[model samples]
Target: MKKFFTILGILILVLVFVGTAVFLFNKSKEKPVVYETSSPFITDIIQKTVATGKVIPRKEVNVTSQVSGVVDQLFVDAGDTVAKGDIIAKISLAPNMIALNNAESQLESAKISLSNAERELERQKNLKAQRLVSESEYNKFLLDFELKKERVKSAENNLLLIREGSTLQSDLVSNIIKATSDGMILQIPNKEGAFIVESSTFGSGTTVATLADMNDMIFEGMVDEAEVGKIREGMELLLDIGALDSEPFQAELEYISPKGQQDQGTIKFQIRAAVKLQDQVFLRANYSANADIVLDKREQVLAINEGNLIFEEGAHFVDVETAPQQFERRQVETGLSDGINIEIVSGLVESDKIKQL
Candidate 1:
């Protein structure tokens, strides 16, 4: 009975050992990898580069003061629409003390001269009446009196101009600021009573208001130096404005800067594009935007996911599925790529299945 029990226990131990070895062997084995497959499709592939920038008016005019003065009255505020020659603001002339004093003194002197000439003319008239003065002498005194009177008038006009920025005989009012072009007022930089310097050849005068034609807008942006070489004038661009929820705006590339500017560690080139407005869409100035410049485009071409392509030895290849769970390497000619999907110029047709990597 003892031998029988021992033999049974040994058999149980052997069975346990065999079961553990079988479980470990099964766990160590690796499962077969099933690669996902995809098929090429006919789609439009647009190769484009992105540029960061803002939307601004193509023609912006700074309404500056023509004479030094303080802003007395503003006719237009920011966002007001104005026509050419529209009054933007009124300035109260702050004439120079020296110039004002000089004008006053000149007027006083001219008045005094006129008074003496009048007295001399009256004496000459009396002498002529008594037949003591000759006709030529009387005529000379009359002319002198008239000349003195004219000098007084001229001095008075000069004083008026210096004090008020205008004269009775002049049509142009230097104290009134007007719009040079038809546009919307973008900003009113100066408040009422703010002092402004006059615009002159020596300096850029104070800008009282900023005006721009909102209808004529442009996309001003910068592109990296690497992609600048691929872009040119007259290309099409789609602008995405961050503030608007509408579709992208259409634009035409108009200007490309001849020089490059360095930002951070990368060089960037400036570019400008004319924006084509759509109905019922209003674009504000300086709206932050991004531009997608179309470099090349292929319509309705056979394309596959760019990740499915295998590039080796300066050539492009793809693994085309021959049967279920089987693939064969095939070479292909490529065209434009939009970074996500690539255009297959010549390769397997639409019916061919491609192995997705």
Candidate 2:
């Protein structure tokens, strides 16, 4: 019985040793991973931030009425070019009958008093000349006559204002709204009879017309807060309008919002750039566009495909191809990158070959 038990133990130990040997043999035979490589070359490296917004004129005016009245006639239509003081619309006075009648009655009463004073003045003058009245009494009557004449003139002027909106004679037109500047009428919200309200502290009021100089076009976009600090005013910009195809338009950075706004949980800053549009190309206000403000640019920079770079433990590394199917690790000092290619400011010249994967 003891001999049989000892044989079973020996068999189990042999089987364990065979399994361990097979596992070690398979692990040692495993193949090394093959990596792809690419060589560094001279290329342009441009860095920019993309923003989505609309195309608007640099100078736009919302022509509004200063006085509230019924719109009688519209002289200019949309797309019409208007000069300063050009009549854009006309407002007919909605006469206030009660106020007009009250003013007229006051003027008539003042005139009647003026007539009585004039007669008294005449009588006093004649009496004084004939030595029939005292000089002090005649002087007092003359002063009252002159005061009554002034009061009648004031009453008449007030009557004219209530009836005609202005005291000027020669049948002056009422509320002829004119353009404040020379610009193209982009929009005429009020047609022939659209009533527009005057701009007040409460709001901008109803916009009568939208005028803009189409020649002065600009691109408005937003930059991510992460990149807003790197941009500044007067930086050259390249604008790629989706409607204009791949041909990028040129512009200059004009403004960067000082305050940050949260959008989709990501903070972003607003940026505006003045774009120089072609004379023939007409750009409407609020046209969507993408802008690239080049923070830094290089003509012919030593660059490599960004894919060739490898990251490990907070350090940047790359695989350089030494021979066919052979690669070695290389540390690179990089400069600005356009997100697709990386600029090699130092380390790894054009002669070095790099792996893409």
lDDT per prediction?
0.94, 0.81
Can you write out model 2's per-residue Cα lDDT over 17-90, one digit (the tens) per residue? 99899999998896977766567889888887777778898889998876566788888899999999899888
- Model 2 pairs whose backbones collide: 37-355, 38-354, 38-355, 55-287
Q: How far is candidate 2 from the true structure (C-alpha RMSD, Å)?
A: 6.8
lDDT of 1 by residue, 1-357 (tens): 999999999999999999999999999999988989998999999999999999999899998988898999999989989999999999999999999999999999999999999999999999999999999999999999999999999999899988987888889888999999999999998999999999999998999999999999999999999999999999999999989999999999999999999999899999999999988888999999999999998999999999999999999999999989899999999888999999998978999998999
Off by over 4 Å in 2: 1-37, 133-154, 169-174, 198-205, 312-317, 328-331, 346-353
Model 1 TM-score is 0.92
Error of 1 at 103 (Å): 1.4
The candidate 1 region of ten consecutive residues with least summed lDDT is 161-170
- Model 1, C-alpha of 59: deviation from truth (Å): 1.5
**Candidates' TM-scores?**
0.92, 0.76
For TM-score, the strongest prediction is 1
- Deviation in angstroms for 90 in model 1? 1.7
Candidate 1 regions with alpha-carbon error over 4 angstroms: 1-5, 128-137
